[model samples]
Target: MSTLLKPEAVNRPSMAAQAAESVVIVMAGADQLPVRRKGGAKPVSVDLLAALVEAALPDGFGGVSRIGFETAWEAMAPETRRALTDDLTCYLGWSASEKRQAFPADPEDLVRYLRWLEQGRGFRPATLTRRIASISRIHRMLSLSSRDTLPTRAAMVADALKAARRRRGSQQRQAAGVRLGPMMNPQDEVEGVTLAMLFSVCTSDLQGLRDGALLAVAFESGLRVSELAAIHIRDVDPQADGRGILTIGKTKTDQEGEGRYAWLSVDTMRRIGAWLEASGLEDGPLFRRVGVDRRQGRPARAPQDYFSIPGHTRHWQERLQGRPAEPPLARYAIGEGPLTRQGIGVIYKRLVRAVIDEGMVELEPGREGDLVRAISTHSMRVGLTQDLFASGEDGAGVCQAIGWRSVSTALRYVRKQSVKGGAVSRVMDGLRR
Candidate 1:
């Protein structure tokens, strides 16, 4: 079991202040001696002595909390602390390593370390370069004199930065051409559900009702996943005419320190009302999961021991299982929360997978020749945007309805269908002229 250390335990002497001074003595590997103070009460200096030993412990971001650092320092011997401080200072200057032969001999080790950072640590090229820069800064700071030539380290950092930039540029170029083409066909007309397909997907059940409501909102409002997830039940003002007005708290492009609201179609209100009533959810999270019994292929009649409204529950694990639940069913409950990042990803993946598996929609193959099938929840937003633009909705109207901060961001979603229609219209007009 891991131990928790409190910062208050090491209040006698500040460890950070002594680190530089303690390193010099620790590296020489000499036994520590007690010193007497002149005309002063002698405080027990054992904690300071023990700090030396703690300095030699492994360095990592994981265990480097302020409390942990203090606890480790308090536990070390003063002699060890002094020696380590000396060695660290010397290593920083690259002088002690030459004398004691502590530096790695093989150049291959550095390359291996870089690979390990990229693969194991999942560091992006930019992140890896930053890490190298941090090391270079440390070497410069710790070197005894300013004139020390750390040319090798400087050269390695420069080469890594150049490679990182080249890789980033190549990725941006590739992405600009057909990034969404793999996940969706921009040219394909909206074919699957039309407004009728939306009605077919709706069910009397709470979960089904909620799904229906989400679909209605997506279809009518053309809300982005982030905008949809951020919505609260209170933000939706249901009208008697079956239409509703939604007050969006924030959007992707607009972090402008304020929220915006918009009116939606009547169909959206009806679906949302059906869902809220069926779910028995009076307030709080707009969407929630039902307690499923995999063994019986049904939902629980009464609230299970683990049923909780979103936000009140800290983790998804709490809602996952009962005393007897199948592995497949248990997997469904894991990490699902309303309006969470993970929850959005999970919902989108499941929705797309279900649509594809049930043959409700057929997505085109990615790229020109590749047969790899792809579809995602974001396709709904893209599809809707394309549909609107093709219908001759002006750019300002589209931007306002979609809650886009910039016209350019919305234009990216305006697919080839819109462009092609415009081209055909122009040609027809030319013939008349």
Candidate 2:
């Protein structure tokens, strides 16, 4: 990405300083988007900024391949960015210590490093590929003139990749389903969890409303946990027929940034409406932090969701004139900050257990444990996809419904579900007659 040289704020000391004998080249484009404290009051020289931009280029990335643009990098999921960062850090440390140079542009050095990672550290081929991508990123930081001086060794690095399949075949651990059959709420109450029971025994407060709504929406929508956490108040579009539409602005699949929409079931919409009314939500992120304050005697502030409503912030400000806002005076309290993806998982597990506590269904001794193990932040998405496949939804229909970008992804989801009332399996059963 063309480094925006934002505020010339050096996030941290770069490897260049250590390798280049303390000649500091500010790493261009790190955390340029998020407004932060400026690096220093003194303005940076144009020459230094130019050097930083040059130093930041990956090895073979030329000006023509859109590698210089930051949009795609910025759009990556937080987890992906963090992994890349870690991989790069690991490579730089190893290369500096082993090769006597921190950043190596030569193809031979890159290959040796990969072998070291594989033979010495026992890093898997998949991990090696990720590290290679990171190496490319660091290479891009070097000056364009330096880029030409070095050979375009990226292809050779790719050729050097160890076969992942032979050494350590890896696959994502698929989440287990909460239920089967057409999407339905809990039926009976006897030590099993379901959406109905979870909602029924909710704390009867704002958090309860939100969690219940979140659970229902997650099950109905089949959203990835991160995508679900990213939902905004304005994304919900109500329809005349009681059903609603949900706009997913960004997802892993949407490379072009043109977002897609999903249908919101009538039942799901009702829970969401209840949550909106209870929280006084208006516009902004939908899910947020909700908990009991550690201190005593404090009602929660109005949710930021209500900030768009006229007089909403003013009304609250007027109520507590000079007083600092405290947690709810009552036992429970909620906050306006958004929940991270991890928090979403915690909430899901808590609600699932709550369902079990309410005796939602008669579970055999080990069945509850099975359900507990199966249910995760990803369970709803997996369960919904499986249910759709089990209910005779074709591959194309399933992908569209589940917001899957490819038929292959759709196929992977239902592999385990294939035997559970699957279309071809059901038809094949008739042969026994």
Candidate 3:
């Protein structure tokens, strides 16, 4: 597990500060449940814990949830907190390893780290900006000289951020559009890959059924991969009219868990049903990793991985290092657990590329190669958003359909698509008048 030794190598408090005493800050490891290191009159000081928390937490715009401090830390998902901790720890290690300065990196050295991350490490400008904020928080909690506050080098962090922007430009302003193309005709292989073409090739088999259902549902819902992976079978309720409602139990937008619903088409509902029937899953996660036993016949049921979530008893990463003989799953059995966020994207990419190789996607003359690399798990969501805009659906209405908390986000998608088709660009097209 990634850890930043408290400045001065101070030991961590045995327990966390009580609610009455102070705010809770989680310091969970990959292989264990979060041990509450409460602050009191103890060997480990509260100041050390504060440094660790400050190092791990996000303080920049839209970093933390908009919810109040009452349960905000608790509301911050363990996975998210863990990720921040890892990022912060990695940065500190780099600072020391490079001999830039001491553990609490000096301002002059931080500037070097920024440049190195961009040019040497190949981190984007946006990521560089976030890292600077994290570094700033570290200095605040550790009571060290801050790049932002030091009078001699005040605006040093700002200068780094400005340099980052100059290097790569604004990331949010770039959202590529996905346009529909000819659907796959089984006999005649389609060359250009379209969302419809890709979905059509995924048949009603074990893996195909799951991929088809997920693609269709994602297209209709426009959910992030995390939201899609979090979906449980119980959350889906089919309506008598063929359309179904999907209750997103949790999301980045609805951090409070005041669940929202997104409508799915009858087609998507049917695809989901097909997968469910084939998998023999009564309940639990709807999307799961496919069993890759590669055995001859259908095998016995594999045991459910109960201790496989946050504090996984047998964390995959650790297991890999030791090199176990047998594979994770002995036989082919669908999991009762949800798919990992990374798995969703991996599956989507694999399926799309599979169809592309099979000549199922018809493309324009030379764009086939570029198109394959471009389509992401989000292609379905982006395509749907673009389609909605082209079909004249208003921003507010689209937001409601897609379960977006704000119409502003939906507007960005619309605006992005609009710019591609903007009249101003067309006037200067070909020969100028």
* Best model per lDDT: 2
The CA lDDT of each predicted structure is 0.47, 0.61, 0.60
lDDT of 2 by residue, 1-433 (tens): 1211111111222455334231211211322222323432233332333344344445564433334435445656555655655665576666657753434456777778888888889877767877776566545544333545443345666566734435565455566665433342222111235555655666645567688678777888888887898898778887777778888877767646698888887766777776666556566778876544233434545444444546745566444443445532323333454566767877877777777777766778767767777678877787677667656678898888778878888778667546545567568767865
By TM-score, who's the top model here? Answer: 3
TM-score of 1: 0.47
Candidate 2 or 1, higher TM-score: 2
lDDT of prediction 1: 0.47
lDDT of 1 by residue, 118-236 (tens): 66655567555554543333333333124345432645545755665665532211111112122233334554433444345444333455666676665566666657766767778
RMSD to truth, every model: 22.3, 17.1, 17.9
What is the per-residue lDDT of model 3 for residues 395-418, given as tens digits with 9 covering 90 to 100?
788777776668776676666456
User: Order of candidates by lDDT, top first?
Assistant: 2, 3, 1
lDDT of 3: 0.60
